[model samples]
Target: MEPDIWGIVWLSLKVSAVAVGVCLPLAFALAWVLARGRFAGLVLLDAVVHLPLVLPPVVTGWLLLLAFGPQGPAGRWLEATLGVTFMFRWTGAALAAAVMALPLMVRAMRLSIEAVDLRLEAAAMTLGASRWRVFCTLTLPLALPGVVAGAVLGFARSLGEFGATITFVSNIPGETQTLPLAIYSALQVPGGEAVVTRLAVVSVLLSLAALVVSEVMARRMGRATHVL
Candidate 1:
């Protein structure tokens, strides 16, 4: 691969990893709430959480820009308070990717949490275990497979994020230029088909690898849960 392509690959990996890392705790919390909490406006909350999945990627990107751009309210506050800027930056790209990937992560985790036997949790609780302890010892262990799957899905989605990332951060090489952005850049040039093809292949391979690893880990987790 060309040095440019390598750089793009590295940036893509970095952004996706960071996005997933930032998203994991939030996603897990939301998934737990959606899975177990029975309350008013639950449906509304779920819809709001999944709005990104239904919205156009470009629209989501625009919303992010409006909310997190340098002059936007949150953006300005963050910049003034913490000297953090998201506009035209790699961090902005990661934020966009995380938003795009969030729904998948939440959905997977929700399903996994829902599938866990309530009896086990209840039993643990009845044995004087605190709610948090029961969750850590029973619920979370059983839901590990699903959590892993969700993370893998989120990571893969982040790797392929294009419209949102590009709209929010633009395609600046060696900065916010991720794999998908690099492919888009390659396509605009004369006789860049080879580059496009190479990047496309790399993208497909990376996605496939993530899926395969997710499956393997989920299966292993399932086996461990069964033994426990």
Candidate 2:
């Protein structure tokens, strides 16, 4: 392995973890709203949530840039108020990754939430649990398998996200340069074939490991739920 391999691996894991961590609770809330709420424009909201799936990655990156670039509304306000900048930074990379993974997260969480038997939640309420408590104590636990699957998949996707990362964060090494970005950069240089090949192998291993982990987690959650 190259001396930088460990650094690359660590960077990928940290960025993907941050992306999933930031997206998970928001995904759960959105999923809950979609599953249990009867609000106007919900269909529209769902469409917006799923839009990134259908949109090109480069286009999504551009949209993120327009919304969160240093001079952009949200980014500018944060810079002025908090003295933090996102453009071309690792945080920007994570934000791009989170956006790219959000659709999958929402879909998985929403499906799991919908599959939750409302009758069980109602039964908990009949036993005098409040709605929020019922969700925490009964419904959320029931759908944890899908949540774990979704989070793992999102992390895997974030690890490979390239166009969005490059467009948003510009591939600064040891900064915004994730595994995919590092691989892409290597491919653009003369006699970089060996490094690119090694990175590709690393990418495949990481993705495969994530998949296996996710499957095991889902199965474990399913078994636990059954045992309960």
Candidate 3:
């Protein structure tokens, strides 16, 4: 209803979209490695990647702050080399959301990667394709459905992310106060019941739409790969 409400919705979508975009490829690559590799300590890597899934969001945010805070090593490197900063910024919110969504995305992609027949990849290699080529033509295509599902799931999760985003970026309106933050703020005061109700409806609708779209994308990808 209010312009601020629309602004929050738009900001939420943009942050979610950017987080998913940055995380999707990394998730796919890591999923493939975990699904196929037998290297030592792989389990440790997997656990680390999935840590945010079980950890308290506030704890995750605090860890992120320690790692990317202005005095942190990464923050120093980023500031010196890339002229970039994330602390207290919307980008920090996206990072927190992305980390929170990582486990779901990786799980979907790992399942998809495992579902692909290794024999098909071998067959592709025998046809004079390099390992890279086989991955591109066989493994990746076969895992397409999972990739779409993972990306969509991550995006949807990021859209509603609050605890970590707020902890990392402090929920500044028009910057990091996304949909969930906006809803929470609305509910904090008297006489704002209507705004909160509308935001709740919006949240539900957005989540439902994400689920529907993900299913559609997965089906399309499956058909393209003849995966059923």
What are the root-mean-square deviations of the candidates from the true structure over C-alphas? 2.9, 3.0, 2.4
List where candidate 2 sits over 4 angstroms from the true fold.
1-3, 223-228
Candidate 1 lDDT score at position 210: 91
Q: What's the lDDT for candidate 3?
A: 0.86
lDDT of 1 by residue, 133-188 (tens): 99888889888887888899899999999999988999899999999888888888
Whose lDDT is greatest here?
1
Ten-residue segment with the worst summed lDDT in candidate 2? 219-228
Task: Give the clashing pairs for model 3.
Answer: none
TM-score of decoy 1:
0.95
Q: Estimate each model's TM-score.
A: 0.95, 0.93, 0.95
| Model 2: per-residue Cα lDDT over 109-194, one tens digit each | 88888888989888889999998899789888887876887788789989988988887778888888899888878888888889
Give residue 12's lDDT in candidate 2 (0 to 100). Answer: 86
